[model samples]
Target: MVDFYPLARKAEVLHVPMEVYLMFRAAGGPDILGQSAAVSLLDWFELDTEIIIVMERPSPSMDLVTYSTLHYPLPEDTVRDIMRQLVLAVIDLHNKRVFHRDLKSNNVLIQETEDGIRVRIISFGCGCIVSTIPYTSFTGCLSCAPPELFLERKYMDSPTSVWQIGGVAYELFNEDSKFFNTYEWFIDALGMKTSITASEEGKHFIQVCLEESPSKRISLEELERHPWFFTTT
Candidate 1:
């Protein structure tokens, strides 16, 4: 059992019932069930820290809701550091045979500490061990999800993390996401209508990380050595 401490004793609340519950419940319990699964997954990795939890406040105003707020937005330089930490943390989780089926900014949290930026990947409510493989299938943020996950197969693996991490890297460096603006716009941008383009090394790294085929995606260890990371420092 792990102990969860409160990061912020008091914080503002934002209540927005996620659509995943309604959509999955209507679908007859897709791969994973409820937010607990996501919370559980993060626990297995031992990445659930107080730094990730601002405060847990009851919100009777909204039906079935909870809210918390962080101290500040993660800085760009700090984002790079946390990305490195996450890469190592993720590799360790995989070694333990766990997979974070759902990876997204909303699911990740950051805390500023005297030592440095502390990161905690939260919301394992949809998390599952690689072997158990939840009966509730297809859990992930639409933008970060790899193409294969959306296909008829309905199963996700480690590479899913790679793609999502790629999306994170793009967001951290560019301050925008293809998925955040508009679905159609993101699609059109991916189709080569956008002016955005990273350097050769950065482009190659992102491309490999976002590869549709899991086999082609770069491993976390490989990502550690990417020039983008080194160049940032």
Candidate 2:
């Protein structure tokens, strides 16, 4: 997979994606859902103004946005399976000490295998090394950013990462989520809006992930254990 980014922004880009692939490979992390969740970055080099990234391209894949739009109004069980893999993918990155600050729907790729649907997280352009220190500047899609970035002007690792995961869910489950902001997210996430079609447990999972206060947001561990993942029907 070759991703093309604007030449103007090439100078500012870091090799976080490459770093993540390498680290995960070195750690020998197991695959998620019987397939490699990590998108391997073969190599990258800048040419004058633009940067060309060579990565592994999964056969017959589409981004999550396209996938979800194609399967519009995805059922809760399918959403549950997808989210389980997604959260696990996120946890895998965090475990490798990588922070994919921009974890929106567009960054995820979906592959339909003989067994089942598989998800691969792509685009580490907005990623960074995980650190205990908070990030004062945000490097992700503005509308997809978390409330802590707007409210406190700084975002820590766990809270912000968890929020981004929730943002992905919002995009999948909520109507008219394309133009959202933190304020809108604040009000809409208080509870599952009528536009969101989901079970009570699923609704609660998203609500907990998008809590207004950073302190109130769910941790990755808690998210994996969320009841929604285990709910049937």
TM-score of each: 0.58, 0.82
| Model 1, span 1-233: residue lDDT tens | 33332222128342212222212222212233222212221111223341232222112221101111122233445555766766765665566555666666566555444665444555544544555352336665665666665564554566767777776655554423333222332465565323334555555666677666667788777887876677652
The per-model lDDT (C-alpha) reads 0.49, 0.74
Q: Which stretches of candidate 2 lie over 4 Å from their true place?
A: 1-35, 175-180, 187-192
In terms of TM-score, the best-performing candidate is 2
TM-score, cand. 1 vs. native? 0.58
Candidate 2 lands at a TM-score of: 0.82
Clashing pairs in 2: none
Model 2 lDDT tens row, 39-101: 765556667666666667777789988998999878878888889998998888888777888
In candidate 2, where is summed lDDT lowest over 10 consecutive residues? 25-34
Number of the top lDDT candidate: 2
